[model samples]
Target: MKRVWGSFFLAMSEAIVPLERIHSLIVVLRGQRVILDRDLADLYGVTTKRLNEQVKRNRRKFPEDFMLQLTGEEKDKVVANCDHLRNLRFSPVSPYAFTEHGTVQAANVLNSDAACDMSVQVVRAFVALRHMMINHKALSVKLAELDARIGMHDEQIGEIVKTIRQLAAPEGPRHRRKIGFHPGNR
Candidate 1:
């Protein structure tokens, strides 16, 4: 029984989330890309009810900026964008949505040593993910600049080839030709 429980705990711990998912998670949260409570619960490996309970239990920690209940319009927009959500005929009455900032704040709100530790790890992962995104954006801009320069060089080469072709062609009408142009003879 102890072994089984330990294995369960280990599995839950392993499911916390990898760093790569943090960026997408932030986008879903802050970008108003709505992920339902049920979906979030699955991702976090917690029951939806339990997740809501946790949030309710620490309501004071979550400011309006950190978390907000989704408005009807927002929910409708989400449903429209997601084919999977088409079956959701009604908006969730009390579904709480956490923004990226809110999720970070949540780490501090939960009243447990484990929660605190997990929050710290999650926050660090978020920071690393944010840095990676910024770096990727910078690299993309640099690559675009390089591409533009290469295009310009290609145009210049084409122009040089055209000029060379023109110079090599016979200088006049078909019957006309230049004669005896030599270095030593005027």
Candidate 2:
């Protein structure tokens, strides 16, 4: 029983790391969210070479939309922007970038218990990130609408202030009413 419990705790701890690490691995390439092959390998507890081998074996499963090999320029850009990828800067081969679906497919091809477990967390992280982006976009739209409304009100407010100032100002010297009755006027 103790051994079983120990393994369960160990698995849980291992699973916890994937959720956190996978989120950090996610990057934007060509405006699409993707994870690099090296990063995915690290997450799956495999070597880059092994991971690439599996991907190569299952080439038909990964369509263009699912996976793409980063160009030299793109690879350089990734290395430049991401400090964690500094080691990859000297790598002989440019890394293959996998979209959300591709990452899932890789997990299926790897066919290891760890890969399957981590894949679930990876997918969860992607979904969470997507939801956050959607919410941010909606909030931005609402803010823009509020800004437009405020701009319209600014002109109206200025006009109201001008009218109030005009009403409050003394137009000219006020004519005094006669204290006594004026015979001519009567």
The number of the candidate with the highest TM-score is 2
Task: Kindly provide the TM-score of model 1 when superposed on the true structure, using C-alpha atoms.
Answer: 0.63
Which candidate's lDDT is highest? 2
TM-score, every prediction: 0.63, 0.83
Q: 172, model 1: CA deviation in Å? A: 5.0
Residues 103-126, model 1: lDDT tens digits: 555544444454454455556666
* TM-score, predicted candidate 2 vs. hidden true structure: 0.83
Q: What is the lDDT of residue 73 in candidate 1?
A: 72
Which regions of candidate 1 are displaced past 4 Å? 1-16, 21-26, 29-46, 76-91, 171-186
